[model samples]
Target: MIKTLIIDEETVNVLSYASIKPLWFTDYQIPLSLEQRIKRVQISDKLFLISEKTTSESKLLVIKVNSNGIFSELDNKDKSIAFDRVITIALSQFGESISPGKGWGRYVSGKKLSIYATKRTQKNKNRLYFDTSPIDTNHIFAYALDSNNNGFENIEVDESLFLDSVTLIDEAINSSWQNTVEADDKTQYGIELTEDLYRSFGECLNFEQWYENKLTNEQRSFVDKSYDEPVRLKGAAGTGKTLALAVKILKDAYRFETEKKQKRLLFVTHSFVTAQLVEDMLNSMDSEMNWKFLEHVKIKIVSLYDLAQELLNYNLKKFTPISKDGKEGRKLQFEILEEVLTKKLLEAKFKVGVLGKCGDNFKSAMESKESRKPLLLEILNEFACVLDAENIVMGSDNGDKYLTSSRENWQMHLPTEHERRAVLELHMGFRKYLKDLNVLSMDQMIADLNRYLMSHEWNHICEDEGYDGVFVDELHCFTRPERMVFHELFRLNKSFETKKLPLFMAYDIKQSVDDNFICTVKKGSGSALINSTNVGKTNLVELTQVFRYTPEIAKFLSDLDGSFPALDLASEWSELTLKTNTPSGAIPKLSLYSDPVDLIDNVFKLASRQARSLSGKKTVAILCSNFDLFEEYLIAGRIKKYYEPISSRDDVTKLGRLKGKCIFSMPEYVAGLQFDMVYLINLDKVEVDEDNPSCGAYRRFVSRVYLGASRAKEELHISACESRQGYSPILQPALSSNSLLMS
Candidate 1:
């Protein structure tokens, strides 16, 4: 009773491995067997093949079983088992490879064959079942036989049964910050604004409408709507956690304190730039009523890192900062809880290098600032030689060697060594801050980062000297190794801080790039925080009613996203790409040269055409990573080039949003929002040829490539530097894809 099942398009002519072999039996060993019977297999509880998949449309399943009634008597008390388990399978001969069915349908489904599904026996009854997955469609077909048995020579099976794969990934094109979601629709659970407060917030909302005609995307509405006790916001990347927290701060700012005679609530956050931005936006609003909190101004701001930094810097009267490491040290030592953190950063010149050709895809995972593999690869060939060097790598056990010798070299243990410890400590601090604020887990991490930032540590330092609470912004960067120091801060039962503990913090937790959790005073209580919200999922909220973009662009970008891989999209959700509605205009352009010169030339031509006008006030943006490349395009003047360098922090503030005329060659972090014109470079990574002389650095530039391409408004024309086409398609789904938008 061997079972076998196959599924494909209902309308298509499904062909078997026709004319290969008839039904017969033989022992395992493929060289002797015919050409068609060999298929891929996996063994487990009740072996199954990862053969079938489901798209947005339909699902396909393939199964296999023995002809000796091996599956017929199975006692499947569990409802999870499917009916296909009892069918018999027929086998044929397969050559070295099997042909896969092709179409523009969803994806590449698993092709499965045999599996080692052991039998389960019940009292006085023979039973059989496929013990592998009955859910999550990557796998199809189940079996209890070792695929190599070759017992059957004459069997018939379809060659193209299952096909297609769908995964979640980022397919977004980055845009300026001002590109906002409209406020036409309120959030799923928006908090009510009181009479006076409502008047003020409504006034600000009106101002936002007048200024940008849009609202921020709907943040997960837990803390945003309800203010009770102990709520926390947390999530990775563009999940809108920070936006939620920001909204919470504004809504809550004047709500309390004024109702009772309590002190005004303060905002704690990460940096002055962020604070300045928030304050600026808040000031731009017009209030409808005579709101005491807004009029009296109870809300203040601060940074936790600045407080600690000041402690070390002044030492009551301290001074310093010459080098980057030296500058990084003051913050690292405090976050690491080390009185003096001493470890010289490996010198840029003497650094050891290994794994010369692995490329940048590997670098994204590195936790360290420096990488030696690139440096190592440079020295191998005289032309590729970065410098003369002796390279050696050791195996994990230290009992082995790779190419050269030096058991457990620095290159081997470098990336995660320092930063992991440091960041973990800060992570714990964030948890403690949330607990103290009574905002334990309701909100996501990104929201937690924002709430932490709007703490009163920065703007309201004077108020906090004698104040009862502590709040800080940019907690991740300021509070290195968050899990460690914050754990102690979270201690309850015993009074660790009779006066106060400096636990307030805010950060872009999504961008922290790690999954560090807050240590709990109570274990189960901590567990609750882990899955408080659907952290990794997109479409967690209803954004359709909130969407502000043109309907077509919104739909196009989101639709294009389904084509990209899941991993890439998971890394970046903030940026979404949509070509602009602005008609073609000649604005001066800059050749941001992350790509090669030819790409610069071509895009330069395209941009110059749009940037230049007869008036000659042509201001175009030629964005580049480094300053030297910016000049190269400026000097070439290929397409009416306008070169505006962002050398200072102040210049960064006005780069994209600057009025009158200007060209912007901005960095990745500062590219979004405020920019009227933006042209990104290298949307996708092009494969490099081994024969090419420049294949050397191609591996090192992956991250810069991802960060660089995301900065654009409207038109996204990727200029492929190399001849290679096709990049891992990045996902940027249309907002309308979610029925919530339509609703």
Candidate 2:
């Protein structure tokens, strides 16, 4: 009788030369690759005769025979057999070189074999062959066979070796294989194989199954808690803030169904891409709660911009917000501002003294054609963050309000009433241009919707159609007026008149990359929302442990956080920390290439190799810092097969359907999503002058790098071409702390 320890479809081919047959085999249902399956039996005990039959020839085999049965069947007269010859013959079947040495020790595949002697025999006289290869712990102590010919025929079955070998092989197989066994099955050997897979690879790739049983105590508490007032959940990147919010939505749908209550819930994200991601998250949580129940609950997941468009369409017959034209609305707004400045304001008697009063070389910046864009952007930021955000209309009572109001956050650029009046004039010109076109900007659309929501007609409509609860993801991206709209959208539930509306918001101030949106949530301000007087009191919940990326990534991000003093001041609303609950992984690789083409080629080759080795079981992202590099990689035919460019909302919406291809995107486009591995290319393109590290450009550049680096859940590869000025000054902190490996 023979026992099969492990066998695959290729087992028979490997065993054909030895003329061995396996009687029975057990299907463990582990999804191991063919190579792994072959390696498993190649390093197994000789007695474990493992073989499988398929439609084609088998490729792997591991044989384990019953020692007593084999010995008894041998002729009694020829009691002594050459055990070394048998071991050599069995190993030769694998088609690898084997060197002979004293005792049982030999070299196979450049790995030395260790000799283990049975207690009954002398240590060096009678030995068993065990390969102690550094290939991995799985292959350690794999082979076992007697060496001494003196007592080879009298070799008794070593029960201890037999049990230990089986246990080691079982552990190895479980680690390499996917846990495909049914949860209800009682005969399964291992239940934590999926978790092991997540730790080895990354949980982001297997998100549907990753968090079902892996939620930390803090995450679970957030999901299961009932809110009296509006709740604000704040955490650094990878802290599971979005995951907790999704689970709460699922649980709420379940509770509504159980109570036989009809409820309307709203989930708001920053953009169409993030909205699609939220929908995918909800669909993936079907195991936690039946998704069909959500039909009765009437949950709406939409981006704030889209929601504003829908509301405007409902109120006015033919209203359309200006299309951003693939530049995230920034390019279009810049064109309008340029038209207002160069064509309208500059042509008119524009107060040149106002530019001089703005300080920090504002006049020189406006005079130079090359430096004019940043100047225009600063003026535009004032309009968006102060004017539109506060609903201050030019030539109205709010004009006086803007001049007298505390511009503490805006004092750097707008030092006095002169600059404020100039910005208001530009705002008036921008509005006139938009009014002539009959199309509103995204901010204008949101402002109109906010006014509509505050109307008596909207109050009457809300009584019957308003949402019972509202959830906001990435709340830091929303401006003051946008935040106010969330409070107005939810109706006062009759059962909880004393409590605030059930508005839940999750945000991390460090991840806010938009220059137009300024964070106003102060430390110990007793409010998490900016200008919270409009939204009322809210409760803050901080998630301290990061469950997405490894400790190495966490430390790298923490070092980055400490390097930026401006980031600390901006994030004073919460004490940001990056403590991780994940295992330690490879330090992020920061490689500098002399040639730009070589950097791109090397990064893609590394990604391709990783994709092949993982068998497309993991997701990879290559985030380019600028559009030029992004487009360059998109057209490069050599690496096109390995990745798909996520440049538009349609591409982002199809992310869940993408298979066997890495995601190629800019850092800003892939916000609120994560990957198994991330490669940030062209950090040298991110212009940040060390002399003015406190500049807004430096802050925006740091935010972009942080966003891209935080996307990696397990591994991060950051590469750049060495410019004439050397590496980007932004990497100094990571380099000084030795948090990044120079590959």
Candidate whose lDDT is highest: 2
Give the alpha-carbon lDDT of every model: 0.30, 0.59
User: Mind sharing the TM-score for model 1?
Assistant: 0.40
Residue range 1-743, candidate 2, lDDT tens digits: 23324333233223222211121122223323233323333234422223222222222222233453222233322112222233333332332221122222222322323233322234324344333322332222323445444332354434444444444444343343233333344544221112111112223422334445767777777676675667778888889887788778877876787787888888887765565456556655562324533556877777776677556652123334554212255546877887777764354356455555555565566556656765687776666556776688777898998876776643235667766776787788898888786667767776688788878777777866788888988877766666778877876434355667778888887777655444444433434344442556666678889978999998888878854535334324444476776888999988888766787778877776776677657878889876556877788887777666777433453353344567788987777677889999888843666787766667767778888999998899988887534467777778898888788
**Candidate 2, residue 276: how far the Cα is off, in Å:** 1.7
Identify the leading candidate in terms of TM-score: 2
RMSD in Å for all candidates: 34.1, 23.2
Q: What would the TM-scores of all predictions be? A: 0.40, 0.64
RMSD (Cα, Å) of candidate 2? 23.2
